[model samples]
Target chain A: MLVRGVTGMARVVPETRDEILAAAARRFAVSGYRGTSLQDIAGEVGCSKAAVLYHFANKDAILTELMAPAIGMLQALDERIAAHSGAAAQRVAGEGFVDLAVRFRREIALLRGEFPELLQQPAFAHIQRISERLIEALAGHPERPAARIAALVVLAGISEACGEFADIPDEELRPALLALVRRALEPVD
Target chain B: MLVRGVTGMARVVPETRDEILAAAARRFAVSGYRGTSLQDIAGEVGCSKAAVLYHFANKDAILTELMAPAIGMLQALDERIAAHSGAAAQRVAGEGFVDLAVRFRREIALLRGEFPELLQQPAFAHIQRISERLIEALAGHPERPAARIAALVVLAGISEACGEFADIPDEELRPALLALVRRALEPVD
Candidate 1:
């Protein structure tokens, strides 16, 4: 939150909650989710454990909040894809997925590392359902084994690309990634 | 080992060494490398812990041996790609990778689930070197960021597809994978 400084000039106020989440994300990424603790997050944020706890109930709460935006975007993409059918649906799903994956690379890295079990948790279960819908939309013809493989490839390929080309600027990588997904989801003869 | 039975018939003898390795892989896959123990391996194989230790010195030895085949094949792919230049190299690399990924879905699952830290060890170091080589081979023109992204996507995408479409038979998934990769590596305007 912003507030006036001592001299009456506008200044940015510290948002301890956002800072805690940022620290937690960094800690969780460097060390596995299981390896990181509230203390570690607090230490990174230059705060006490009590301060960290003050912002969030626990580690899961912090992670869930950090992930909330990504999950929301994914759900939005699923909803968008639902309106289209066949090839149009596949294109929409591909574009939306690439955008989602690019914007949430850290979340993808977090999901890929140390947290498959988390997806089974009630909080993350809905993500699995959204993913299934996105996959179905991307597949075009869901019954064909070939189409199924293509859709799966696009879903996973983009996330992989995000990590692999982490050094590349998103603006440069985005088109390449989008093109790859478009091709990967294309119907095979 | 085959031996003569009491009735003078050739009987296939139980190879305790192979049995121990098989049990260790299964245990490691399901419970993770760190999560499993020699006692678990021995119990699964219906052998004593000493017997398990006698065959393999430790858990790392078992993992090293289990991953030996995959690392070997990946090196072979890298070597095959070295002989060709440009698109031919990309084609050979893609086909070789698809074959390798299809044949080692369980190994990929094992890598994905646990033991990523295991990759940095001396025993698994060669896999990393080979993977970089394979990535270069897959990318026809490494200087272009787009080409780089495409190659990285296929490398990780195939592994992801292997797990995502695990239920699909190799004969069915393999050709579809190959086609999708072929398209992914194609030049984009």
Candidate 2:
């Protein structure tokens, strides 16, 4: 009976860990860092608080895992956008924005939600650096504030629209959105 | 001694609340929602956990309050954006985008930091709704997906630049950013 209990307890650990992460994502997504607790996460997983600690050190670790996929996806999207260079750069950038907008709406929303704290994290600093590099590569100058601002505006607006404007279908908004971005990238008079 | 303690305690409530919020903002801004704690916050404010809770019912309430000001500012910016109409709409929208870009940079960075959950709160939802309304009012139609998309692209690009490209000063960025936004709103082939 002791051996069986040990085996069963071992099986419970991984499942409990997954459960804790899932629960933590929901709570953190809604309540943020300060609002959640190890106790609350343990309760959701139907495990002891110590069980949660065994799998994950703390809530921060849980949040880190949850957002890892999102960060990866964003970087991938950046790569895809960068792939659209040369004469087709403009069109490719537009399509990339549309693709990202349509596919990653939920992730974008989560990012927007968690963004304030995310910005301060060392993990996110690399993403910012990557973004700046991408902007420089695309605009041909790290110091082109106008181009940088224009790119940011387009990206943020798309994120905002995709996450919030569910009533406006993607197809309807995609073309106009691209046109706007292209215009924004144009040299100032 | 009891009377003196009671008076001291009473005097501490409002100040403690403000202190907690301020500290929470700093922590949340760095560590994010899942990374911070009421205990950490209390330590910052030089108070007990119970005292922190005495001011805020929970972490959610604290985050909600921190985000409240950002939401209000966005709303006010939207109102200001809406106040300009007609042929001047494009130019006014450009200017508004620049102003909001400057204002929202820190808060947006903070949003990206710890209190990401605030994005789901009604406060953010309200900002989204108001922004949509402002877009509609400026474009004079919800069906103008093209124009709406254009506006979104321009505004979003500018906002993104402000946060990710802080190395660039506002004086150089602001006017250039305005021009980029104006260009985005212009007719495209």
Candidate 3:
């Protein structure tokens, strides 16, 4: 019984860590990193700061981990866009982008809430590269760099609208938002 | 000679403050508020933190002040769009919106980067309201709500391209960006 209990307790460790991450993301998103404390995260997780530290070396580590899903989702969406063919591909890619935008509010808000200085950090270089690559891929018209610009604008537009103005109902907003992006990607006269 | 020196020094004060603000905006745009220190700003100004603070109360105050021109510029853009009259209002608005997007790199970046959460704070309610009103006025497409969404999307699109992706060169990149916004604002088929 003791060995069984130990195994069970071990399983809960990862779960607890995830709980801490979730709590931290929420806190960091709503309250800027400076405004939040490990103690606050501990309180939210019903654990000690030591335990939180065991999961993450520090606040920055936790934040970087919390933001992983957002980055991953964006990359995955790009892959999905590449895989899909025809109108279905466009719709799927657009929806995935929209879904990520709507759901990744905390991560997006946290990033936007911080300064661009975050971009200069070597740790975030992957994100920049990914963003640039995504733009390059999305710009089907190499002749008109506007397509690339439009892609970025659409990407940023969705992120801002979803993150800051989430109070607006998604059902009412998604179609219009998607329509706007579609228009943005279209050729100019 | 003494009176002349006093007048020259007095003129220098505002000029110095403007220079400081410019430096702060550049640093803050690149490094963010937490990453930046008064010493950094002071060093750039060839002074000390005490001297920096003499010009502004604190980093928060500096941030708030940094927003003044951004707010004014957006407000002015709003006025320009609202007052635009004639057959090509949509087309003209698209061009004007793109112009604002290119020029608003620092302002949009600062707002989206450092002040996103500040939107929820009671103190920044006025600022929030101003942006909201501006967005509403810009996107007031009488034909449909999609127009409104498109307007917000265009603003957001530019923000994403310029604010976060600061590495992109302007001369080579802006035409594409402007084209994207122009397409986004065009009447839907």
Best by TM-score, which number? Answer: 1
- Write down the lDDT that model 2 would get: 0.60
- Give per-residue lDDT, candidate 1, residue B29: 65
Model 3 lDDT tens row, B1-189: 013245545554545677678888887766666667888887887767787788887778887787766667766765665575433445555565566666667666765544566666665666666555545544555446667777766666566556645666667566766666556664533
lDDT of 2 at A75: 78
Q: Fill in the DockQ of model 1.
A: 0.48
Model 1: per-residue Cα lDDT at residue B70: 80
**All candidates: DockQ:** 0.48, 0.41, 0.56
Score residue B31 of candidate 1 by CA lDDT: 58
Candidate 1 on B121-185: residue-level lDDT in tens? 78877777788888887888888878877888777767755545557788987898888888888
lDDT of 2 by residue, A40-157 (tens): 8777777778888889876567767876776786677677666755435545555565666666565555454345446667867777765554454434333555565555566565
Local accuracy of candidate 1 as per-residue lDDT tens digits, A53-112: 887887788888888888889889888988988888888888888888778887766655
Q: What is the lDDT of residue B160 in candidate 1?
A: 52
Q: Which candidate is the best by lDDT?
A: 1
Off by over 4 Å in 3: A1-18, A32-35, A78-96, A102-110, A115-124, A164-174, A187-189, B1-18, B73-104, B119-124, B141-149, B164-182, B185-189
Tens-digit lDDT string for candidate 2 (B147-169): 76666545444443344645556
Deviating ranges (above 4 Å) for candidate 2:
A1-133, A164-173, A186-189, B1-21, B31-35, B54-84, B88-94, B113-129, B138-141, B154-169, B186-189
